[model samples]
Target chain A: MEFLRTLPNNLLIYIIIAHTLFGIGLYDMMFRKTLIGMLISLELMLQGVGINIMSFGTFLNPEPLTARVITLFLVGICAAEAALFLGIAVAVFRNYQTVAFDKLTELRG
Target chain B: MSFETMVVNIYVLSFGILLIQVITGGLIAVLSKSLVHCFIGLVIALIGVAGIYYYLGSPLVAAMQIMIYIGAVCVAIAFGLSLTRKAGEEGLKSPGPRAAIPPTVTLVMLLATLKGLSDRGWINVPHKINEAPVGHMLLREYLLPFEVISILLTIAVIGAVSVALIRGRT
Candidate 1:
């Protein structure tokens, strides 16, 4: 109970959470069969990286502005990435008629 | 308890709840068989991330997190999900013995690296809250990258539209 008061201020806790999220994302990416599920897992991984950046900015950096600017840039990039990938997914679905990972082995050698 | 202690306690409690929310959401997003449920979990996890940004003293980033992530990205993903056909007969396959090995190895390596770094006292530093300086620097020092990103986003939009249109016509 006494340690709870210090939890929010601890950088290590954020790191652990971010790492765990990344691990979960990795697990899902490898296990999920659908493209949409893989995309969701990718987003989870990105969010974990975002947390890591914010935590470092808040606890370790002298100038917080740089981190915030970087985060803003990251958000923009993520949006663009999502838009592009969703478009690609739609196109893939239109052509192939399925979003399953195993069914997408058209180029397998 | 002193005023400072009370404030710290409140922060801790809120953070604890948010952390749990984030972890649970991530788990659901990754583990759920239903695509819609996965999206919901992603939303919850992102909201928890926004709360974390708020705790980190960046209200602006927190707001942007909600706006961009929850509003734009997730919606785009939902639209994508809707465009897809129904789930295939072979639902998510359980990881085989070989498939399970890499992620576990990666996780163990990552945890070990993080622990070693922390033990080495490499991540310690003093920080302060300063949102005003962010806006200032954005227009000054980071102006070029900012403009480039705007251009990049414009290009991405055009690309996405063209791609969708081209596929539809074919």
Candidate 2:
């Protein structure tokens, strides 16, 4: 199938997949009760964005390396974000003794 | 079949498989009840993304994705889970029927948008693989952001350690 050959290399397919991932991540972020679950969803969303950028870099950019450079930066930022969030999650668990989003009402006043 | 056609077929097949893997892993990561299982799904999904990156012609990014996501982030999350055993023990609450509507609508809307854009003839563009430019650009033009990221990483490490330690002592 000619279509099949083009599908893998097509930018549109990547865009669709990236958007699907974003949708899934958003859904999880809204529904998941645990802080860790929320963090995981956040990572999923970041991955979607990363893929979208990479695809654009690969397919549309005149300067190829720019996208990869940005992607490298993205990876660094994501690692830092994950570390800080996990640390905060750990601190929250220590303080509240629970990581449930609904139970974290200490600052509700 | 000619050799080129066979090769193309194989490539398409692998791409299809990887795409399916990515979707399945993402669903599992988002929907799984257990935290550990969720981490596992994330790892799988990230691996799929790495594979996609490789196909997109950036093996370096693929390697980084595997190392940073699977090796560092997931492991760190696992450590956090272990530290907070009580949190991991409790099953996550499902968001309910209303939760399903938003994602479905979002997916449909996104698909429609993409289709419209493609119909307007703005989707496909030519690609070239230039591996050497990445290193040059990183060291030359992107040098400032690169150094800033290093500093940010250092600060993140210190801040995380301090936050984790302050509450841990009590």
For each model, chain A TM-score?
0.95, 0.97
Q: Candidate 1, residues B71-120: lDDT per residue as tens digits?
A: 99988999898888474522357877856764676578667857666654
- Give the C-alpha interface root-mean-square deviation per candidate: 2.5, 2.3
Q: Model 1 segments beyond 4 Å from truth?
A: B1-7, B89-91, B99-106, B112-116, B119-128, B168-170
Identify the CAPRI category of the predicted complex in candidate 1: medium
lDDT of 2 by residue, A21-90 (tens): 8888888788777778888889998999999899877776766678899999999999999899888888
lDDT of 1 by residue, A1-109 (tens): 7666656667778888888888788887888887778888899989888988877776666666678899999999989888888877777777878888888888999
DockQ of candidate 2, scored on C-alphas against the true complex (2 decimals) = 0.63
> After superposition, which runs of candidate 2 have C-alpha atoms over 4 Å from their true positions?
B87-89, B108-128, B168-170
Q: Pick by TM-score: which candidate is best?
A: 2
Q: Candidate 1 overall Cα lDDT vs. reference?
A: 0.81
Task: Give candidate 1's root-mean-square deviation (CA, Å).
Answer: 2.5
